[model samples]
Target chain A: MTSSTTLRQESVRETRAPVEVRGLHRAYGARQVIRGLDLRVQAGEFLCLLGPSGCGKTTLLRTLAGLDAADAGEVDVPTQVAIVFQEPRLLPWKRVDFNVRFGVAGTRGARAQALAALEEVGLADHADAWPGTLSGGQAQRVALARALVREPHLLLLDEPFAALDALTRIRMQALVRELVDRHRPATVLVTHDVEEAILLGDRVLVMAEGRIVRDSDTTGITRDAADAVALDVLRRDLLRELGVGG
Target chain B: MPFLLLLAWQLLASGGAIDERLFSSPAHTAHALWMLTTNGTLASNVLVSLRRSAIGLLLGVSTAVALATVSGLWRLGEELVDSTIQMVRTVPVFALTSVFVVWFGLGELSKELLIAMACFFPVYLNVHGGIRNVDRRLVEMAVAMGKGRRQIIRHVVLPGAMPQTLVGLRYSLSISVLALVVAETLNTTSGLGYLMANAQQYLDTDVIFACVVVYCLMGITADLVVRVLEWRTLAWRTGVGNR
Candidate 1:
């Protein structure tokens, strides 16, 4: 067990950068959301942006995903990028399978791909189920499946698991980690949860006032170490950054 | 309960509590219905009305959809057409009937054209609103997924706007029928409306009542057909109907 664990740790340590955003800025009317934000996501690496509400983490992620245009600066992204919003945002009129394969153009093999994606998310049984009938967690899983099926090179998540309960959130986090590792896509996750950042991210970026304050490598820490030391340290550091605590 | 109410109405009319001249007894109305059915005039008039309504509905809905699509896609087109339609929609169908009769003469063309015009605005407005009201996020998602304009329209915009369009279609259908009847009365020599108008001249209240009943039945049937279409086309929106 120790040997296998060490092997896993060593593998994750060798990260390759796939996406680079330099001095990205975004402003909504008078309020500047993301200002001079610079981020680099390694290929096959999980990076989490931790911040308080309105700290511009989501804005940064959206900018990276190309959903929101950057006000200034450059973003070098892969041709294929997928985003998972806080809400599932599934097409309510489509069944689970169709929603998963919504991005797949043309009809000939779309159904087959949709079914396969549903199977990947463990929702094959719900292929024909309407999106309205899905639970929150289930819907999020479908959304993740939707992103996954696109075979994206860069995956941006905007507090996707924030609304889920503790246990379901953990399960989903593990599922996401597994899928990311399998797909080997460069992933950027935005969240306010320090533990989540420490548990799932190879690197944790701390943001405040529309700028990144710190970027820490947590790749060397094991899950138990993350829970015991890394998370607590990151939490204190993030709180301090926000002027909440010393 | 409806039958009981009708029976009560029949009793009152037969007892002379209601004037038989204006309010014909149910039995007399039923007898008139039977006579019309036997004479085949009712069936022919019904066929004529049905044909006009079907043509008007088809033309109205297709034209509305085509116009809405074009306008929704192009800003300049929308600006030009939207104001014009809104202005025209304010003109009452009854008021337009005389103008149509004068322009097209006392024929099926005038009646059909008037019905189509009446049906056009409601559907066009709803479809336009539906397209405009589509969630921007969904459109962005589609664009991110590399969907072209046509694909977005086919997969996202049409489906999202369907419920609202269907509601408009239902309203337009009923309006079409009402307008068709009025148009028929004003211009055509045949149709249920014409039969009722002629009966009124002779003070044939039973025939008038029978024609009115037939009109109500046609309206109800049209509504039911639309409901069925809604159910079938929007099977994806099963529970969303209540909303």
Candidate 2:
């Protein structure tokens, strides 16, 4: 699995790359959602996209996931991609373990892999539980486990933890960070939470009116004592850019 | 509750206010049921009736599923099948009995075809609606996870639509048994419906009551079968009464 991952990354970088959107444009009949956007995410990069409602971050993510066609320009992503939506989006009839194995191909050692993924999300004990029985936080964790189990070259998350309680949201953000770090997929998380962006991303891109307006490096901005003020300043600047408190 | 109804029926019969020709008492009905069972013809007739219903139901359910899947998946297929089916379904099923008899003769074919027609629409409508109602976000999620078209249908769409499909099947099961009654009564020489029809001619209230009991048992059995299937297949439903 590790070898294939590196090999795919090498081939991807040699040609179209894992996730490279350049001069992208998308429109919904009368209204445009993305316009000539250019962004490149390296393999193993955790990039958080932050924007107000209607800023096209979700549209960009959907385009990358291949759920929608790009009206123009390039969206070069690996064909094997996984997505975790705002809802768990589970097949309710299936058990919890099967839901976590949603993107996986077959049952050859799949149960163990699904269990391992569930273990990563701290829900291994609930692997047999139904999705309907899960709390929102647990369901979102299963969604995360599902996205990671396929060893996807790219993982797209669209506000996956936004519906959870505040404490659950914090724990989920940390869980996502850990999973992304361990699995090392090219991750793109779209969320409106500025602090979540700072806490979880290697870099943060602020989008507005279908274009990226702020590209801030969030690496070492949270844990490093020296960068405490820098982190605070970046947070305030992002909030200001988003028309939040000055 | 059933025992109380039986006791009330016994009391009514003993009171002698109601005529026996109109209805048989519980003891009389039970005695007639025993006689029919001991005579050895009732078992074969019940088997024949059940077989016809099962075959007709199978054929109907298979066709309904195929057409429903086609219409549910593609816009062109829907345009071709959905509206046409909707129009045909509105025509009362029994109204086609004469036309079916003229076309296929009074053999088992006509009866089975009629039963199939009767069973078809309910299953088709419910399964089609179920497929169309499968969560759009779930399909989106599956597509985003890189599942191909066949994989999406097999793994996602089919299971997602199964609850509604089962409801359709449950309804069809009931109609199948009762359709057997209609079909058997029309031109059959055997089966419980034949016995009932023959008893109607002679005013054999006890025998008619026995046949009615068999029909009720068949209906109840069909329902219990569906309940068992639902229990096994739909264990995931949280609020389901059974599990």
- Identify the candidate with maximal TM-score: 2
Score residue A127 of candidate 2 by CA lDDT: 88
Candidate number 1, chain A TM-score: 0.87
> Which segments of model 1 are wrong by more than 4 Å?
A1-17, A223-227, B239-243
lDDT, residue A43, candidate 2: 88
Error of 1 at A25 (Å): 3.2
Mind sharing the TM-score for model 2?
0.93
Error of 2 at A34 (Å): 0.8
Regions more than 4 Å wrong, model 2 = A1-18, B238-243
Clashes per candidate (backbone, < 3 Å): 1, 0
TM-score of chain B of each: 0.95, 0.95
Enumerate the candidates' DockQ scores in order: 0.46, 0.60
> DockQ score of candidate 1?
0.46
